[model samples]
Target: MKPEFENIPLIKNEEKKRFEIQYNGHFAFIDCKEMSRQIALIHTEAEPELSGTGAAAAVVEKTLMYIENSGKKLLPFCPYVFAFIKKHPEWKRIVDEKFEGYNQL
Candidate 1:
């Protein structure tokens, strides 16, 4: 399910409760909960075919951009999202620094 990273649109499927990127006819997504003006990234998963292709990382990056650009705060509840923010600390600006476990990130 690996696909070209560029030009791919991230979809915030509110009814589905996830941010999604289509790949190889499948969907790679970040399961999320929107609450209190925050997007709580609960889990990240890609089709097994996309594994190791870094596709999930791209989805996470796009999701972060959506959160930041939309002025929505982040609650990186998923370990992958947390690690992504930890690595790119600049994205931390979209996170509520006061959140529990934010310091661990």
Candidate 2:
């Protein structure tokens, strides 16, 4: 079996409108919003120092986990999330591929 994502400390920055994972003062984030039964992912970002560290991958996993557990489907608008899906095809079940802008990718 693939290794399950570890639970990293995260802050739900409601005011900032994103879930953030901070490390050594730098951070990675997944910006999302709920729309009825869907959770639209607005974007994903990671500090340059944390890039390629799997921090963003963990953020994407946790974001999808939160949406799935909340009984919502996903509209993965973020390019990072789409790339994450390409690497983790098992997550495809929760993706709403019919979303407009995502089709162009």
Candidate 3:
């Protein structure tokens, strides 16, 4: 169930507090909030047009890359992100060990 994300631009839009992929005039984004030095992924959404299009996984993968590259830790409160990490265990390294859900991953 891999998503096609290699060509998309993943943007960290701090003004709106999201990591987004703008596609065909709409956005698929991971809404986030900062807690200390950790970024908590709060929600995930895609326009109706992008629903069921693997956009969720695509956005999650890119956001994980952003977190890893920026040397930031992740708190995946969003279910989709949690599931994605559960499926791709390698990304678990970027998650904050103190997160209550970390044991589940």
Q: Against the true structure, what is each candidate's TM-score? A: 0.91, 0.80, 0.90
lDDT at 25 for candidate 2?
A: 71
What is candidate 1's TM-score against the reference? 0.91
On the 0 to 100 scale, the lDDT of residue 5 in model 2 is: 34
Indicate whether candidate 1 or candidate 3 has the larger lDDT.
3
- Runs of candidate 3 with Cα error greater than 4 angstroms are 1-4
Overlapping backbone residue pairs in candidate 2 total: 0
lDDT of 3 by residue, 1-105 (tens): 344567888998989999999767878999999766788999999988988788878889989988888788999999989998999999999999999988999
User: Which candidate, 2 or 3, has the higher TM-score?
Assistant: 3
Task: Sort all candidates by TM-score, best to worst.
Answer: 1, 3, 2
- Distance from true location, Cα of 18 in model 2, Å: 1.0
Ranking according to lDDT, highest score first: 3, 1, 2
Collision pairs in model 3: none
Error of 1 at 88 (Å): 1.1
Can you give the lDDT of residue 16 in candidate 3? 96
